[model samples]
Target: MTFENTLHFAQQLDRNDPLRSFRDRFLIPQAGGKELIYFCGNSLGLQPKAAREALDRELTVWQHLAVEGWFMRPDQAEDTPWLSIHKRCKDPLAQIVGALPSEVVPMNNLTVNMHLMLTSFYRPAGQRTKILTIGGDFPSDQYALETHIQARGMNPADVLVEIFPREGESAWRGEDICNAIDTHRDTLALVLMSGLHYYTGQVFDMAAIARKALQAGVPVGFDLAHAIGNIPLWLHDWQVDFAFWCSYKYLNSGPGGVSGVFIHQKHHNANLPRLAGWWGYDEDSRFAMTKGFVPMAGADGWQLSTPTVLAMAVHHAALQITAEAGMDALRRKSEQLTAYLEFVLRNSGYPLEIMTPADPAGRGCQLSLLVHQDGKRLFNRLVEQGIIGDWREPDCIRLAPTPLYNTFEEVWHVGQILLKFRT
Candidate 1:
């Protein structure tokens, strides 16, 4: 498809988009009574229009029923009892990530879930003690892996084998990653990697990596923070040992939204060892105040405490919108939006080196531009012009035109803004 840097071309694309109507479901941020072009879904998604109503409903439930909100369902209200609210997100999430409903569990934040999964999955024995991971994964993941190794009385330097991209290459080559796994297979206790890179917007071939590690008799896990809602995933079918992600970014839940975990049914009955809490105990007999900890079957067994009802309400609303639109339609428009943006940037004569992979299969909606000089100034200018993009340390300005709300014309307007900049 030939992309023209013209408003008419962009408008024509948007006009024919089948998911265009879904844009109205979100509340676009405004500057001086004009709607801003929010291309920041990679960092934080724009709020769904239903967020307020969702919150209000829960607040009303708490106000009226108080303690009863946990056990008893309100006669007039439509929501599930607060005790079983976690059940509401599972099916939609299972559909979104391509897993069985019992395999997914929505719980604590990303890092906390990471720690819990670490406790359960990262078992460093006498011969197999190292964790094979990539360089430049989210810092929090790095810290979690490092500290978890330390807590087990092992040096992080010895336990973590970091892999890197070839020199001069912006994105990781698939073979490089698979080869690293093979190289470390002998001593590798676990393979921990991000399914989609947050900084580079590079989508790893999770299926291939998972198969390689599993075949080598090693467990594999993924941090799906940037991958879950931004791209389609098949954690269950991929045979990924375990995975977790936050819902705020692409799922468009509120800030610090609940995170979710995927544990394959194969591991559900295994006595893999975990840090258990009362909520993780068998639900039917949990109130008996038992001495021994017998976990609820499947992923629900990972729960550590009582659930947060208020946060789940907003997330429930956000996910319903995404599930309604479906990943197939969203992915269709996402490829076009990103390709169109890359075309615009190239033709605009800006000397920006896009850090993300060129192939749509290797990337997502985000196009991370490597602005060598004065990158901060350019990012600030975009913000001043009502184009809400994200900035990272050293030199990256990320623009993510999400299919849920962003329009092709908005991407065209961003290019128009870029054309006016002198430097």
Candidate 2:
């Protein structure tokens, strides 16, 4: 995988990419008929070419059958039907996140799912009223945790413990997080953080953190919005109490596509109270006007309304592509691609700080660049050259070369462009 600074190096890397075939699998938008070098998949992934056709099938079914589509089966001889649409997508979702099919379910959007899981799991009582979290967590997570605390009649200032990086440091170490849990265990109700830091792309120690929190008599959950398809996760083995993720990023589902959830098998029969809805009731007797709410055993019990069929269809279409290519293979190429970028960027000596952790084990496909000056101008310049990356307010620009479709050649070229920006 030796790479050089010339256009030939990029073409050569593209030539050797085993997953290069996948680039054609997506819809790369072009301006004036030239393909843009897309590096923003961390925010919104490129559309799968099959997504439109999949959505059209449902549109056709709806247009022709109207309300009858809900009850009608697509294949009468088998189980394929509109009613089972959510069920159709669950298996592939589970595989992407490394959980059993029964342990995963397509449900509300990310924040909504977080709120639902909090209701069931955040049973704060006695001294366990504080929620321990990292300082640079995504804004949505911070808001959800605070709101949930306020709803429970607690002051967020006292109940929220924010673990921060050491003085003169940029990222929180795993030890610091565990120490925060240990120091505040008696008052910490939940230890929550992103499976991967949204800005820095630093992968957290979920397994170790979950074990530590559980040992300290606290529940641990994760917002996996950035990590689900970008890394190999063992949610079940890690004993994560619950987790949630949106599908539009590495999963390549279209914007506002349906999200998913995971509730570990250990909690299935536990009398943990939940904010339930009609959709969580047993499907077998749902239409029979059931007497009481009997939740459908596993993660499906967390559903509120009928699944969003159209959104789920988009996810189903995207997951099928990931399922075919396999997550492990995607991750393998991902490490190589990111490392190549890091290597080139570091050597270029750009004033931009490579804030993403260096170890492949501690991060994913994305790298957060902190440009020292004119960061916004530099971002605009990259865009002018057909390079697409997202700017996170203040100074950071995130570029994720998604392995399922992005090529190593693109990574090298983007790195060279960043170097050019510095001088």
Candidate 3:
């Protein structure tokens, strides 16, 4: 679509968007008392208007019942009250991540969940002690891997292997990931990579990588922070060993919201020693005050303590929205919106380059762009104009027109402002 024609096309798209009604649910942020065109969902999603109400319900409980709210289930004087509220969200959370209800658990923040998962999954021994991951992964992941290695009495350099991007490739190909697994099979303990890379916005081939990793006797896992709500995933069908994600990003669960973990059913009873706590104990026997730990079976076995119900309440609201929209339906529109953004940028005479995968199956709504030398200036200018997209250091700027709240016209307008930085 040309610059003159882009607006018309965008308006046409907005009219036809099936998910258009969902946008009204959020309280879009404002700059200078005017609404900003937000395309930064990859970093932090726009707040759903329902979020405040959901959290408010908890506040009301706190005001009235105080600590009694912890044990009062409706129609049952015995049901653990506020404590059981977290369980209410389990099914929807599981459905959103494409896992069995038993395979997913709402728990701590992202890095803490990763550490917990790694404690169980990253048991490198003998010669196969190295963990393989992609370079340019999110910094938290890098730190987690390094610190985990040292904690295991292993040298980070010797036990952590990062495969660099190919010379001309913006993101590593599936073949390269498979090759790395095949070549290092004898010595590699695990393959951990971002489901959608934070810097490049490229969706890695999780199923393909999982298949290869399993075939090579290696367990595979993903950091799904950027992929969970932005794309369709089949973790159970993919036969992934494990995965984890924070709900605050694409799930719109508010900042520092409750995160979760997924453990394949096969591993739930595999006698793996986890960093367990009271919450992981069998619910039936937890209050009985047993001597030894009897895990609650499946993903609940990974929980460490009583859940943050207020945080979980916000996440439940977000997941309910996602469930209503359906992952496939949102993804269908996301592909078109992102592609349209790319199309408009190509027509602008700027030294701009889109680093996100061009293939729809290999990407989400996020598009990470390289702006040669004036990236920071261009990014600041866009922000000043109330066209909000996030900037990463060096030269990359990231934009994500999330399907839940972003309009096609917003996408086009952001593109127009980006085009202005060409000269």
Candidate numbers, best TM-score first, in rank order:
1, 2, 3
Task: Name the top lDDT candidate.
Answer: 1
Candidate 3: which stretches are off by over 4 Å? 1-4, 73-80, 421-423
lDDT of 3 at 365: 94
1-423 per-residue lDDT for model 1 (tens digits): 888999999999999999999999999999899999999998888899999998998898899899999987678666789888989999999989989999998999999999999999999888899999999899999999999999999899878998889898888888888888899888999999999999999999999999999889899999999988888888889999999999999999989999999999999999898999888889899989969999999999999999899999898999999999998889999999999999888877876899899999999999999999899999999899999988999899989999999999999988888888844
lDDT of 2 at 274: 92
Supply candidate 3's per-residue lDDT for 247: 88
lDDT of 2: 0.87
lDDT tens digits, residues 39-78, model 2? 9999999899988988898887888778778888454434
> How many pairs in model 1 have backbone atoms within 3 A of each other, for residues 3 or more apart or on separate chains, i.e. clashes?
0
Candidate 2 local Cα displacement, residue 111, angstroms: 0.4
Count the clashes in each prediction. Answer: 0, 0, 2
Clashing pairs in 1: none
- Off-target runs (Cα >4 Å) in candidate 2 are 75-79
